[model samples]
Target: MLGAGLLAAAGLPATRAAAATPASTSVLISGSLASYSTFESKWNYLYPWGDSHNGSALMVASSSNHNHVSLSGGVLTLTSTPYVGDGFNYHSGTVYAKQQVLVDSSWPSWEVSGDFQAPSAKGTWPAFWLTGVNSWPPESDILEFKGSATNWSNTYKNTSGAWSNTLTPISDPGAWHTYRAVLKKSGSSNVQIQYFIDGVLKGTHTGAGFVGQPMWLIIDYQMEGSSGSPGPTTTTYFRARNLYLARSSS
Candidate 1:
């Protein structure tokens, strides 16, 4: 297992000196939909990244729309248009922190929490995940969905093995829900990733450590079949608010 501090140290990108320092960050990006698409010749957007295979795209909104996303008052939000494709099979929205926030090496434990809501469609897939800009797989899948109460799963990635488990209370895609996770460095390289739903305990993963790296948080709303279809099928949507990130004072 790796120490959380070492994990944080390992994840820093070479561009670190120019990114935001640990304390806090605040920025706003707003514009019309037509002015954001690369196809429309507007490319000044700060940090918009999406995958066609993932069947989703993201944009900045001066006011708000189907895919309006941003960070305000210490929380992140993702709002999208109504998705009609393949039922609930596909739709997603995502955003990355443009100015990286360094993990406070002084804290032995850290936590990231946020609220999310999926569109009313039956097949929408959504996630609030963390990943290392330096690697993949060992990336954290902190929160994920499958749309089936019997099949919902949350996963945590670690060096030893990929650990996963089932979850229910089944997030209502049409309404808001809160989620939180705590990663505690308890040993040389072992840490625990704890999951919470609406601030209540849901699940926990212990002894998995992939922390010795600089990582970024990702909130996404994915429409099913968007990644596998030969063409666009239907529309999908997601709405979110009240995101929280804090490090244990200990």
Candidate 2:
């Protein structure tokens, strides 16, 4: 099933599952298995005041002329362009799935996976992450590239005050690579998270306090925080596609 209760706020009705449930399995929520050809149909642009971290960029909404986001050939392109507006010299894009909030106990297990081509320019920080709906610390950086040759992926469980991360080496940020995370119940009120890149298992961690609480997704191409000052002088772009999400029976 599509988890109508979760998507109702976004105006998307829950749809019937496309296949039969396994004898030992149930799918709680499933995103479109096909490509997302339009931005508004599945996601909403996020506008954070003052741009988080006071970066040298403004996050803009999707529009016809600005060209901050586009979808073609099953690929969604998110661009960061130089623009002088409101004393800021650059503007970029950030978006979140319409079904934003997810709680660990809502389902037994869940998976989030996608193909990404990171932006390579200096001071360009692009990330696909999850954050607590009501607080910070309970966040997961499924994929984060801080304009470096290495990529960082991590999970944070605030109640336990623990974090787990993996640093993977990469030669080309512009090349498409697969990234995924699986979160499943480990013990009472706790969960184990596994991170993967290009089909290889990268890291694992166990944490509590994430269960039974809400977390929302975030994807953005930011500038000059820990990525350093003076972002790309020219326009830079990041691409992602084949984003898939599903919940499994406990």
What lDDT does the true structure give each of the candidates?
Answer: 0.50, 0.72
Q: Which one is best on lDDT?
A: 2
Q: Model 1 shows how many backbone clashes?
A: 31
**Collision pairs in model 2:** none
TM-score, predicted candidate 2 vs. hidden true structure: 0.80
- Tell me each candidate's TM-score: 0.60, 0.80
Q: Across residues 89-198, which tens digit of lDDT does each residue of candidate 1 receive?
A: 32334655442322334555667765666443434456667666565544455556644332233555544476577465554545667767777676766566777777
Instruction: State how far residue 17 of model 1 sits from its true place (Å).
Output: 36
Give the top-scoring candidate (TM-score).
2
Off by over 4 Å in 1: 1-92, 98-105, 120-122, 149-153, 158-160, 225-235
Of candidate 2, the 10-residue stretch with the lowest lDDT total is: 27-36
